[model samples]
Target: MTTDLLSLKARWADLRQQQPQSRIRDAAQQLGVSEAELLVTGLGETVTRLTGDFRELLKQVTSLGYVMALTRNDVLVHERKGVYEKVSFSNHVGLVLGPDIDLRLFMNRWQWGFAVQENGRKSLQFFDPQGQAVHKMYLTDRSDEIAYNRLVTRFQDSQQSTELAILPAAAKEIEKDDTDIDVSGFRHGWLDMKDTHEFFSLLRQYGVGRQQGLRLAPEGHAQLLSMEVLKRIFAEAADRQVSIMVFVSNPGCIQIHTGPVHKLATMGPWFNVLDPTFNLHLNETRVDQVWLTRKPTTDGIVTGLELFDKDGQNVALIFGERKPGKPELTSWRTLVDDITAAAIS
Candidate 1:
């Protein structure tokens, strides 16, 4: 169906009046349009098309003092509140390293940008070619409003069209049968894993995808788990004050949260970490599979709880926080052991 801006604006107004608290992304889906398309319709009113160099603009975000960086996929939203510090870029890869506002950006996937205002709230939102939000920066009361205005004015796209061209979602890679892989070689590589980073290369060498690799691994290496495992892991970590790393990614970027998470709740289809500096809203309903995976690393056996969606896309990765030259945390390893034993029993 074709989208008409005037009609869509009217429809959006009616919908907003009916459900004042719904998010724009949700409302856009309900209206059968892309979220970026919906935001484009507000071009002259509440949205300003942004242009100039995205990288340059990102480099200057540090001037804003304190802001919130948000990245998500279909099932998870990761938000970090702090100043954008230590910004650097190498080709299409970008990094924001600091105690807060950490990010890994595949810069080339950033396709669209907008400066939006609603009910006196403002933010800089960016999207990929397929209309998936790659990242967002929101100004807080402590942020430098003057810096934000300067950057917006400097980079405002000359076109500012009220129409958007959103590409369709890419098809998922087809899963391969275990019989298609060299089982003996795959097993040998699994046994030889010297670090978590080596798993990717092993998958490449075995001509298999990540999920396929797990499925093909020997029974003792990877075991499928129930959704209940996630709930218990969070509760157990909170109770024990364990620092864990939660990795969530989009096609264009991966956002990592490292520290202790205590405020966790599940409401309807969403699992939330309603913390002060970091917030994660994960969609438990979209979860299709959970795997308790043990990978051999130079440090020792590294265990992680991996969640996958129906399309086989990794939804989230949960691992105990540990640096190089250290074995997995004893408590986390014990928790994994107990969970695995319980699942088997």
Candidate 2:
């Protein structure tokens, strides 16, 4: 190891000794380094760097059946237990249409991967160029350990260096003033949407940030709500049996759950969905803005609750579960309408 890396590893060890319970992600933050950078210090010990076509490696994940897929951003973590099936890629985007482990992957953002074994638990971790984790899969008791071992052995990088090349994050673009935007044209475009997927293209076309777009939404299409409404929404969804889609993403991946959420709880800053196959833990305190948004879809109008953190980063998105050619669920629409009405009243 180089002198710098040796020093870094020593410092990391000392930090761990001081804060034994701190997660690696938090510890890396405390040391002002990326998680992948710190994580590499354990190379050839508990972690193995894997270098190859990640897409090809991902296709083999099915062999390690029934693992726990985890994806998270700054304020929310989404976990689901399932086998990886129906994996497909088109250009830089990939999709895992598995019944339980559904994900939308931005493959181009993925830069590093590792096979990790910590505290007797094994996992495959993937990270962005900035060393931030994009997605992870942990082995459950039911996972095929032999398959995982074989796959890791096949792709382990020959170079086991404890050094990582970190990329600086791109600069943020300053949003234009409201007066500078074509509000009339933007509203028209919002109202003219034919599919929910088109909303993203519409945003790019208008150079509008998500919250900014919400602010400019056509009449009755967007309503500002309070944070407390999140609790009510969960309670109502559970009590009334409303199946919904929960979407949580980082820059690299979007993990989705499309079904009913039950056994909701709030402990400290977290609001949780403790379902059997899927789970979500959200930092309620991190939410700086909550908006009820309605969008035009081919089947009909679609409604959802959007949450954002103080930095205008999306915390999560909750929408009624619906498939193409199917209109928005009347029950879901009524549930949201009633919640909004009650909150406002």
Candidate 3:
């Protein structure tokens, strides 16, 4: 190990001694380093660096059988347990459309892979060039250990270096002032949108940030939501037995859970959905803004409840589940409208 890595390990050891329960990601944050940088300190011991086309590596994940897929951003974690199936990649994008293990992967952003073993549990973790985790798949008791071993053997990097090349953090982009944005033209294009995906193009065409677009939305298109209303929305969804889509994503991957959410609870700062196949843990306290947004789609006006953190980063997006040719569920729209009216009152 280099002198720098040795010093880091010593500091990490001291930190772990002081806070044994701290997760590696949290510990990395507390130590002012990327999680991958901290993780590489155990290169030869617990982490085996892997190199190859990650898309190809992931295509072989089905052989491992049942596993737990985890993807998260700063405030929300989306976990689903299922076998990897129906994976495909086209250039820079990929998809895992399994009945249970659903994911939308952006291959171009995925840069590093590591096979990690901790406390007898194993996982395949992937990260971006900046060393932030993009996605992780943990091997369950039912997973094939032999297959996992075979995978590591096939892709392990030749050089087991303890020091990871940590890239400098990217500078935040400065968005244009609201005064400079063509708010009227943006609203017109938003009204003309036929699919929800076109919203991104609208933002780019008008040089508008997402929240700014919401702020400048046509009258009745967006409503500022009270933070307290978030819990109520969940309670209403569960009570109404409404199937919804919960989207949580980082830069490299987006995980979606499309079904009814039951068994809601809160512990400290987290609001959780403890379900049999899907789980979500949201840091409610970290949410700084909430909005009820509407967009015109060919099927109808699609609605979503959006959450954002203090830095204007999206935390999560919840929408009523509906296929392309189907209109928004009446029950879901009613539930939201009722909640919005109650919050207003």
TM-score versus the correct structure, for each prediction: 0.94, 0.97, 0.97
- Name the runs in model 1 displaced over 4 angstroms: 1-3
- lDDT of every predicted structure (CA atoms): 0.86, 0.91, 0.90
- Indicate the residue-level lDDT of 256 in model 1: 80
Per-residue CA lDDT of model 1 for 232-270, tens digit only, reads: 878788888888888888877787888888898989888
Give Cα distance to truth, residue 313, candidate 1, Å. Answer: 0.7
Q: Rank the candidates by TM-score, best first.
A: 3, 2, 1
Question: Model 2, residue 164: what's the lDDT?
Answer: 78
lDDT of 2 by residue, 62-165 (tens): 99999999999878899999999999999889999988999999999899999999999999999999999999999999999999999999999998767678
Native-vs-model 1 lDDT?
0.86
Compared with the true structure, model 1 gives a TM-score of 0.94
What lDDT score is found at residue 221 in candidate 1?
Answer: 87
**How many collisions between residues are there in candidate 1?**
0
Model 1: how far residue 335 lies from native, Å:
2.3
